[model samples]
Target: MVPEPSSEAPAKSFTDIQTRNGSIYTHPGLLSLPPSSGTSSSSGKRHRFSIIVPESVTDQIILKCKAIASGTSVTHVFIAALAMALSELQPPKEESYAVRYVNHSMINLRPYCRAPYNTREHAAAPYHTVSAQALGIDLVVPGPPIDGKDDGQINELSQVATQVRDYFRTVRPTSSQDEQIAVSPLMFKSLTTPPGSDPHIVSDPPFCPAVISSLGNIGSIVSASHGPFELTNVWAASEPIGAGVAIFLGTWNGRIELSGVFDTRYHDSGYIRKFLERMLDSVSGGLDVDNCTAPIRVTPNEEK
Candidate 1:
């Protein structure tokens, strides 16, 4: 007897991703339209992401992350959340080196769009970016993700970036402003979502916090420079937890590098070394892709 033909069809290529949108819940980053109650906006626009990372990854969870990035594009974060909390939980009377600094970028939509608006539609709306650096000051209070609550405190690292986005959102007609500043309301009303792969899937890796190599990934669109912008390079101090950070970087061969900062006392270079090794081992074990220890085509600095 002949065997029955297989009933399953082949998986669709990436081109078919749009069909899956309805089945997939909204991306974690993008804010839902109508916002949440008092937080709603007249523009009907919201953010794609509020904060990064689901919550603190437990040790077991860390193991799974190691499996993915070990030998693949994924890289494991070496720092532990507990240690980061401890540094803030118990601060020293004297100043300590356990602090983190971050530089973020924002887009100046004014230059690109002659009108003020908030729709995802204007595909041609050019963007001008700005970068701002912030240092973690005294840990006046415990941060969220500690108690497992997402709140304003959790957003401190991103305050500067958010402010920049708001700046573009609220640009209004003013007498002092030139006719060039007189944006069109129709442009704003026509705002619609852009066409592309879902922002959620094209995940970028996080930055390594403790050591600031020239190539480390960091920055947000709201804070990124617009033109012949000078590169802003800043070293992040470690947190009490570990010496590592994470970033969602642009192309590896691009003009800019993004990075995140961590307090070394919380995270250390040694932890990063171990994390990187484990990551390589984990990826090799799971995927039949490659061994990352190829001849270093790029020098250590270049890898950064």
Candidate 2:
């Protein structure tokens, strides 16, 4: 039987880790730029699209990543794949001005909430009345094409995946309740501050090139029946917040869905579609994985 989820607060060691890495918000290079000065009215809003990864393919990806990177998980592989896709789609031209892709992933704090506040049962509770919280952490990775010939595709992805895994392992918060609460005020302050004043008031700039949020396994959540209710599909979407792109990953009924939110000012619908297709192709062995040595082609998907 599955054990009940823990409601304990994070430990002291965990809080220490969070405090040390809090600089993510203030990193100068990670700061975002305001929407272009000559922006058109249409450029003000965000757009969204989605792609589904069948369970079979997801399983294959998991097996492949682990075989190549030892203990790396699917999320690490996916993030590495995303970094690769972004690099392919927008290769930086200048040697000195390459883009350093940064991904901010949401970390759920539900498990650390005290007592009754620990479970999703209190999701409807008012923000001020509940102890639930969530935090975002930056995962920085190299982007832009290398100058030399490409190495074996599988080996390359594995190397990237290992780097991703090591980065997360080093920076992830240590489990501690007090530390989680201590950081809440900072997150709140950052959220309440005006965008125009964020740079001046907040020491850390809130700039992320890309964001990834996983909702974990939702099969059980939907499986809970209510008066003969039956569920079919499950997915989630969100507005593009401060980032050029955001991708939400969720699993239900054994399938994983990737919902990508993009700022139309930066990328169009066609580009988003092609980006998703390329991402799928990269993981599903469409790209030559055994011995290919050239950068993966990133052709746009043709409109019907």
Candidate 3:
């Protein structure tokens, strides 16, 4: 299940995680349950991912996401829409998304899960292992995104919320002595297709479909005015698995954006772009939301 920030204690404060580097000692119990070292039979893979924000900041590019292709909440919306679209275009290995995380054994012996976006401080290791099921049917959009969408329309927020809930239902931590440990430095990729020595097929698939994290959403960071550093949004993602692509999201234009990064070995970014564009166009045009839907649009650019 996606880890929620503790309301009881203040969040860890940091000057600059990128610059400062040191390994802090965490409890031993934290590492008791070893994380799935990208080695599993079923290979969980998360398909869609997103974050919800306000429409006001939809166009503002802060530190992370730049430009407003869509509006606030659009990121989260896009993820849901994109996920649904992908489901139709390329059905995932499993219906549930495989959301990854930086397991911090020190924070609570379990793993300190990163927030969805950039936060106040950039301390502590930002890499660990944890996952949540990205499935379900009810999104509680905080702002405008919730105003006009169809009453029963299951947006990304709703879907992700459901996925989070389901994650808790399935797994439960045995202890709380876990602390900060095993920080994911820059990036992590999933083995989408099962690894093999074959000829025409992918060697590795993602252990999970989606990897959701809260690396950038530090409340203090979000509120502070760091000179020219405008805290626009945050995002997290990993490499692709099998023939499928990788997904990432952060605060873009004040809302969440669904971004994809795939391994060129399986397919080219152009193919993924074409597929996503067509998919977005299909769902956006079909969205019957009266007022809540953000200005959903797809771009025709490749990451390379």
Candidate 4:
């Protein structure tokens, strides 16, 4: 039987979940868009791309990261890699020298659901309860010109992954109140309002530079369908909120797929493409920290 939703609050205060000074980390480019451009009509456009991560690679990363080995899933590793890549893509201000980037990940709450509600039938139901919540995490890494040694890069990635895992374990929601806080109507209203217009929302930052969400492994569940069919690939995309970027990931049949959404008004196709490439490179342990200069654009005619 499905259980009633809990009315109890979490042990910790909801406000405590946010990272102090998180707004400072948001990419300046995203926030700098003209006020008029912040409208949904302007920022609603989205561009998407996908890449596959072999199961072996995912397993290796999990083994190497002690945090993941302890309990967390591979999603933490991807978030860390993405944070690092974005820090590289968007350099810090010359004066501050802070490579602060804030991102939120959507956590699946099906496991938290009680009894029959946790079953596939209920989860797949057209009108399931709010089975997901967005949890925020901020990444602050050293600005560029650091040593590009292979060992250094690996160590950095590992450290970031560890931080992500720790944050998820501690700061993320632990009770129904936490979930309620995450999906609050106020938060939704804040996101729709332009920054600074609403003093309340401005004081509490609603958007970040990027948002990452993972659908996890769904091959088994999908394969359980009535007919005989194979799910070869899966991808997802959503309009960026407030000129920011949205990254969606899903693992199916031992392969992980990544898709990104961005606003053309704030970013071009080439820029978005290069960013994804760098993110994939970071995850695959092929990114050269020293050579992450801006990507060169080549038109179709120029390709010849």
| Highest lDDT model number | 2
Please give, for residues 1-304, the per-residue lDDT of candidate 1 as tens digits. 1111232221221113223332232322221101011322222211110011211222233344344432212221212221232233333332233333222223244443434433345665554323112122222233334355533343121232233333333332233232212222212222333677342221123222322222233343333465888544322222212223432222132222123332332333333333333333333333333442231121111111
lDDT of 2 by residue, 1-304 (tens): 1122244333443455446545444453342322233333433456667766656655565567677756787677667667666555442343323333454445445555565666567764223211223222233333334666332222255666777777666445455334444454444444475756543221232233566666667786567456788777766666665435667766777766766776655556666666666666665653233311122222222121
| Candidate 2 RMSD computed on C-alpha atoms after optimal superposition onto the true structure | 8.2
Candidate achieving higher lDDT, 3 or 4: 4
Top candidate on TM-score is 2
TM-score for each prediction?
Answer: 0.23, 0.63, 0.38, 0.62
Better of 1 and 3 by TM-score: 3
Write the residue-wise lDDT of candidate 3 on 1-304 in tens digits: 2244354231221213322322221221111111133334343333332324244433332311212222223333444454444334332231233222212111222243445322325455343443211123222222223355533433343344234434344333443312222222111222133467442344344222322233333443355447787654444555444544555444444453545654444344445555545434533443432222244444323332
Candidate 4 residues 9-92, lDDT tens each? Answer: 321323433333244334443322112223334333555655555566554544554444575566777787777776665445
The CA lDDT at 68 in model 4 is 40
- Rank order by lDDT, top first? 2, 4, 3, 1
Q: In lDDT terms, how accurate is model 3?
A: 0.35
Regions more than 4 Å wrong, model 2:
1-46, 92-98, 125-155, 171-174, 177-181, 195-208, 285-304
What lDDT score goes with residue 158 in model 4?
60
How many backbone clashes does every candidate have?
A: 58, 9, 78, 0
The TM-score of candidate 4 is 0.62
